[model samples]
Target: MNETLKNNTAAAEVDTRETVLEVKDLVVQYVLKEATVEAVNDISFSLKEGEAIGLVGETGAGKTTTALAILNLVPDPPGVIQQGSISVCGNDMLNLDVKELQKIRGKDIAMIFQDPMTSLNPVLVVGEQIAESVRLHEDVTASQAFDRAIEMLELVGIPGARAHDYPHQFSGGMKQRVVIAIALACNPKILIADEPTTALDVTIQAQVLSMMNDLKEKFNTALVMITHDLGVVAKMCDKVAVMYAGRIIESGTLEDVYNTTLHPYTEGLFNSLPRINNKGSELKPIPGMMPDPTRLPKGCAFAERCKYATERCFEERPASRYVNETHTVACLRYDEPDFHIEGVED
Candidate 1:
């Protein structure tokens, strides 16, 4: 195994006590009619049992594509996992056939997408969705599955345990929880939550986040939370991966990423954090839109907006450089011994 993957598994083992998922050199590409776009460019990471890692990036930064590629859910024709390997428990998932992958997709690996209303089936009852997930993985009768569905609802902090409740009967927060309950109903080893708090109100968002955190500990499931919210990662993830234009710019422990941020894109995320001092001030959003996947820049993706970007940053693509024991960034300038963490004012 490469050193990065080894170290990643080691880092994952720190909190989880066991490695569950390992993704290496994941490259998802989209073959449009006119062009090919690299949605996930050479990304690698791993998750251990009971560990959570947040993948942070803007809307078009290829966060969702990376998540989907992990589950081999990339839509065909337009989208394809062009390269790289993904392994779960030492088994290569990228090489698995459709039928073989299907057996693991929900049974061992589950995902909760951004919009629950769209992701959930409108024709099916909420309980039915959760029960179907259970019955698909386990040998159980319809009645037994329904009872498990109620248990999942209760597990997710939902009030009503009625198995007849439909998606229309629930609010946005409730729908999100139902989606989560369905995701967890199968008792998957790895759960990928993609923008889980997108449409939730502040109070609901916090409650749902708290419930997910509680569920993480209770189920001992490794979590890959893909979100643009820095605060969420700091609160929920033990480690974080900062992505930009299809590649991971930085990866570190929550303390290493938040307390001593190394990459420019990661620092931009700090601008989004809620602050008591900045209550009256305007929210400082990250400047510059993401680069087009079809025409990605030759070097660093954040070069256009990064204040510290040098000619080398744009002229040459930097390799992943390690700073200390637990942090890595794809910036060459930081290879110097005198390199310091940027934007983190003491």
Candidate 2:
């Protein structure tokens, strides 16, 4: 039994030397006419090769904005990446020229957006959509691209023969598979799935997630899964980042964050989830709505909602402090000298 435990512990550790994606102190803001809204505050994280990271937060917490910034897809009119750097495969994504970026996008990194219906072009055949993605990234012939598209369809569990059908002809789950096919058409090293299972039924959701897990392993693709579902995070991710407003308030291995939750916002999220074991227990939802991005609070964005918030929390921003080598929390409570709170050992 001791040997088994030791083996499990060894397997859980990730080698950081081979990082696939790196985002450093990224800041993205929307330049609205009335006021500038900071959509993504100074956030930083890294993705290692063939690992999955879950980004969990309530709506308007800037999860989607961060993903958009990674791909340099944030619209310029209202949205802008003000500061920070994003490096994928050692390529500076933010500094890449348009032509260079265009070459790198699908070839090195691809995204499966939130809504499959909108993401897939209704006018075009599903096969053509995937083929176009491949053709754009690689210098392949039309026939070769189409052949690759059919192979991708097969890879995602859809029949290669059905590739000729248009997006409207397939079911919602199938359309999502086609979208995945398009994203993976070039065999990208990184895949960003933003709420990939949101629109599916429970069974189909499970199926899609299973398929994604299988495909990710088969291709050795690093993944960023953006979702509010802690259940999904527990099932799919090696590490997790809990976001509030625009900043990542807590980050660590799945066991570190879930088993020994540090941030009040993260704890509140777990409390809100209905547990099969805790029958009849009242769900404790986090109090207060997300702050308006245009007029954010002076200190911590979650201070008003955090039950454990103190005077320091409302006065100044807390620096990220490491509870250990792998776990970190941006909370004033951790910085309280000689403080020992329940469920936290410092």
Each prediction's number of clashing residue pairs: 0, 0
Clashing pairs in 2: none
The CA-based lDDT of model 1 is what?
0.84
lDDT of 2 by residue, 57-112 (tens): 98999999999999998999889899999999899999889999998899899999
Candidate 1, 1-346: lDDT as tens digits: 4986787677665543667888888888899988889888898887778889999988787899988888878898789887888887666787889888888988889999999779989988888999998888899999899899999999888864555878988999999999999999988889999999978998999999999999889889999999988778878999899998888889988888888788877777776555766577556566778888898888877788877788888878878876777698887678676866457432
Top candidate (TM-score): 2
lDDT on C-alpha atoms for all candidate structures:
0.84, 0.90
Which parts of model 2 are misplaced by more than 4 Å? 1-17, 337-346
Best by lDDT, which number? 2
TM per prediction: 0.92, 0.93
